[model samples]
Target: MTCSYASRARFHRSMTRPFFSKDRISHFDIFEKHAEDALNQVKGRLKEGYPVDFQDMVCRFTLDSATEFLFGKCVGSLSAGLVYPKDSLPGQNREYANHPSNLFARALSEAQSRSMLRSSMGTNWRLAEFWSDRIQKDMEVCHRFIDPILKDALERKRSTKEGEQSTGHAYAEGKGFLEDTLLGHLVNCTEGKADEIVNMLIAGRDSTASTLTFLVYMLSQYSRVLKRLRAEVLSTVGNSRRPTYDDVREMKYMRAVINETLRLYTPVPFNVRTSTEAALWPGVNGGPPIYIPPNTQVPYSVFLMHRRKDLWGPDADIFDPDRFIDERLKYLTSNPFIFLPFNAGPRICLGQQFAYNEASFFLVRLLQTFSSITLAEDIQTRSPECDKGAGRDAQEKVIVKHHLTLYVDEGLWVRMGEASNSDDV
Candidate 1:
């Protein structure tokens, strides 16, 4: 039987305290290494003259960072330097050897997709997952692939407590932020730690990766936005050194770009909630309130809502980072419900700040390292369905797929290179 729904919620609430504060998750060298790995992936792919898979690069980067941040051990997705070969074994088709935890990443993706399918099934969701052989296999793979890593973390934490603290401490000495992570605090966490840790990993990995993937894709298409962001990064971070936690916060335009991207793409386009008791939801424009019966499931689309003309004005659909900075901003702070990228409740993402830090750090490093990112000419665009009065063309439209989060229907393919002028920005 499942237990601790309340306890798990409480645990996340407790976890959020350290995760959200200004300098909280600040000491993160794991993020720095993974960010470098992401840049390196792009660099390698650029030299090959083939379009780099922005999706895979960010996916590996997030997987590595999330694992190390949460479990005290890295999954090594980026470090392996492998471009996963289709229709081949883990390490079979690339220059770099694949990480063994590739199985874990694949399993986690499959599991999330399967769960999304089930969630779309209303009250009878479990029956669908129960009946599907593919889902059952996904479950098995997840258990087999991720359990050992969880066990290792638990063992490491246990050992550290039992006369090994001095050893771990000595090892952490002189390594910047070596122990500044969530892992060290979990030593005394009892019962349900596995589930809690895995839940965090699932939240931590794909959402950030998907956001970064889409951000890069959007930036390539929206060069003006990228230029401004790169300028902000250069002005704040400079080219010679990696950014500190404080440096990321000071980049106003970078934060605006991220907020705008989150507004448009919102990794989890919508979320669902079931009412345990009857309730009333107020309607818009002074309309009558609507009553919701008990056991009713309500789904709200943050993506569609964010683009509404009523809230965002005539050019609501336009990709503009300036809105967050100038007079156009509202709803985010004034009316929270209309703009719930991370949702508006106790269960709101505990790692939201962690995600911002990770993204900001990487973007700064990326701007410092690369001159330009452009859509690869060899790659075809996804066709648009009915502009229905909008002026934008079919090719400029984005096509996305929904699992637990959104992904580009076709992988985001782009070309990148070293910056021509370090002082340009």
Candidate 2:
């Protein structure tokens, strides 16, 4: 019973399973079952105008949500409006002081934005180097924070060993992804083992944060899209009950909105790959066969590709979910080679299913709960007044900073009101 509780309680999947499959576990499923628990904990605080950083809230919630599904223990980031302690895995926090997760999140955000701008300018390679150094420093903060948790997981796994089989939960139940991957790798591979665990923590924290931040911003910016999403949520789950994973999966419009948002503002704006060997496009008797030697580094800029006019049409800039309404998905072929939000081909995101399901669940819930959302006054009022530069196009004004992931310079801020606002108005 304790084993079951422990397995179901945390975010990291046990080490016995394949390392890659760890993230495939879905926290949205847990969120659905514990919806009332989360709401009862948070609703009162939200009602009091406690000035919760909604963006941070989403990140923390995703963190806890993902962790619980992977491990069996749920850290109370969302419930207490704080980060899970790096030490005892606090079932709850005694006070609301800023936590490691918050500091880590903020540091990652600043580091990424500064780095992106420096790289984009391309004038000084030295600036890029400096940013890289800062990122490394911030990473130390992350390592110090996650190492203890990983150690705790290892100790727990040790405790559960031997003839506890049959009745015993899998290692994933107790130790989670950290133990599973570390233990497996120790048995198999050599070198840089600790680095992989660090990568997971950094990757998990920022990717979920950036994606949800962009999603919320889009939902706030486009009212019609927001309404359609909310309507779908209401029709499928109704107002009183929480949505199951199946219900979230089946919500077509909500999925479409998410797809569109991802298309426009992917979490990873760019990815780079060096050509392993020479490659070619047939029937192009132009220059040489585009000889990409073995050592050549090729970068794929997802941001530019997603925004290509030839692919998405003139209104590629627009946030229209109807682009995905067709049954055959033909409309999506504006540019056959375009749209690699999660990347395409063999190396696609393994956690894509988990991300979509989680995002869909959260988005639907947010829409169901909130009626009106508008840009905060300062961002809305000052955006037009800011002189981007002498010749900078308004289209180019979309700031893309590379924090842990690409985050807007300022966190996406918006005003949200109860879903009944329309009725009252």
Candidate 3:
């Protein structure tokens, strides 16, 4: 356990170093290229008058960008193209569904679901898989796709001797370009452990994709919010040009919308941690302290916490971005723990800023290209019938599915209205 913790800390440090530093502006270019590629595909669907699955497009965008950041070459999931809505005029293309990159994504998602089940079942999870290991089967598919890339990276590493010069373009003065890929950095930090790389891939791909998916879903529901957000995007960055990091930072309303979406639909909604030692919890309203024994498993739900009426006021259940920017923000400012979308403390998400940048960049380009978004409820596969009682979940238009990270059930099928030349600022 100590070794595991130390290894993780070392890996985290490596990631934080030059890769995510403020000066590493090249990453935004990569994000912009992927976002443009994704939006271009969506435009194709729009011209064809076919509804696109926004969730799937964002997933491919993140996957391509994450792979490029990690391996110096993307899996090119975008090349497989945006999938047509189920039973739509184009129908589900067999070749597109069976693309190697798509297969890897499907396998990775399955592996995550199995891992979540194993964690939920604790020590007895193996008992259920005694006859057949489902996760292993899924992982085999993933490995089949990734192993060739790993082999190539390993070969490249072996060719470079000690103190050897790199052939790639240098990003800064005196800093060589070999460390550009996270995989190469991990090779030096953690000896290229496949599992650690996979964990990073999951972190890079799903979390941001989930956030974008929900953000679009929310914008579709509230036209006023969408109009305001698009205005911010157009006014700040214009319609034709790419947005700089500074430009993204300047858009306060856009940030508020992103924050509100994360507050309501955090990608990793539930988390569990084991106590290292006995601890006492402060009671609410001067009540007695609660006892927590050492090594006890503690599971918490940020989803429920972010929605509590007492914490967020009576309109907590409503999808309002104003809570993040208006007077109601005091509730979180006073007690910041009430808003932990990417979590808090030492073990908080290392890629939190990266996720924000990628999401922000993509959203800017998305709103710039598309003037309006309307849900294709007729083609949406998931129904809210399973939700019981009252409140947000009960009245949800799109069903939320939990598989390690939150995702729209079936997919967020939407018809986006393309912006004309006059729509540009």
Candidate 4:
């Protein structure tokens, strides 16, 4: 349902209350289960010495995790199995490539890409699709996958309400009815429950997947950083032991690695917002203030901002997690606005902390399981030259682009060396 900005903000805040609760956030076991499953899938694919599309595997991982968290049942994307580099012997597995969950993921991704294109087109978006609705089919595919789950949730909610009324054990009015999952809570109060759940799936799945993809990509490029990060992971969580919430929190360098990845390859690189009222923005240097009228669409790029030399220092173009931990972190401390991978203010991502936790949990398990990572550049589908830029950008080994979120163009193809017992801390 359509809502005014103020009302929508309130609704979003209320909807996300579950995530803000400490009790809810303490569910690390659920996150770890999905991470372990995804890691095992990666290992399975690499067992034959074939490179796996790590990006695709992580996307499945996040999708399964997000669906389970929001809908109480995972879509089982990981069970579809990991995809191999194109044209390879293993890549010919038509069954794996055409799995139902994989189809749903592709449809969702296509829908997101189309939505982004429409947003970029502004008023002319409709005209481009005047002859036919390009997004309809893909959205139908998505709905087909989600509607049954949503219907089941609604039925469960109805049953619960009837039970409460018959037993005269209705929850107190002020405390609100407690629901076990976000889907239960949403189905209890929202008319557009399906839409809300889908929106959240996009936020939860793609953002974390992108971060993990780039984090791995970055690590593959920098052996020293990978070694140091693995060292920290082993020192803190150890091998074979599942990482707890507190264990993840204690891995400071690992957190820096994640933050650095977010800084360099922000998932939602570009975002737009409409001004609710007239405002004035300070100009650069000593220039006069610039006026902004009400309803003006303001587009911002955290991606570009994150790479600015003046803001992040001369080595801004470089990938160094140390900047986040060393004295150079003072720049970000003094100018907080300079770093905003998750945006800022009232509309900041409600899933920000969840994304951090998910990425960290997965990375910890990954380091524990793998001793080394190398890019399968020989089979990489997208050419690095596709991303045209100077300096460090020009030297990038893989193509990166965005749909609703940043992603490596084809996929982040990599071969991982399994951690031997001797490699363990």
lDDT of each: 0.72, 0.57, 0.83, 0.84
* Candidate numbers, best TM-score first, in rank order: 4, 3, 1, 2
Q: What C-alpha lDDT does candidate 2 achieve relative to the native structure?
A: 0.57
Judge candidate 3 against the unseen true structure and give its global Cα lDDT, from 0 to 1.
0.83
Candidates ranked by lDDT: 4, 3, 1, 2
What is the lDDT for 162 in model 4?
Answer: 76
Per-model RMSD to reference: 4.3, 8.9, 3.3, 3.1
- Residue pairs with colliding backbones in model 1 are none
> Mind giving the per-residue lDDT tens digits that candidate 1 earns over 1-425?
01345466676568535645666678768878888777877777667655677887788888888888775678887765646324335425644433466766777888888778777787588665575555778678767756776565555555555534656443232222223546444434453444666677787888888888878978998888888888777777677578987888788888999988898788889787767678898987889999999767788788889888788777777788888888777645577677777887766777888888888887788888886888764563554663445533332545677888988866777787678563575
Worst 10 residues of 1 by lDDT: 170-179
Best by TM-score: 4
On a 0 to 100 scale, what is the lDDT of residue 46 in model 3?
A: 77
Indicate the worst ten consecutive residues by lDDT in candidate 3.
169-178
Off by over 4 Å in 2: 1-29, 32-53, 70-98, 107-136, 162-194, 280-290, 331-337, 379-400, 420-425
lDDT of the structure predicted as candidate 4: 0.84
| Cα lDDT tens digits for candidate 4, 46-156 | 887788899998998899989988877888998877777768876777787578998899999999999999999998999999999999999999999889988877777
Clashing pairs in 4: none
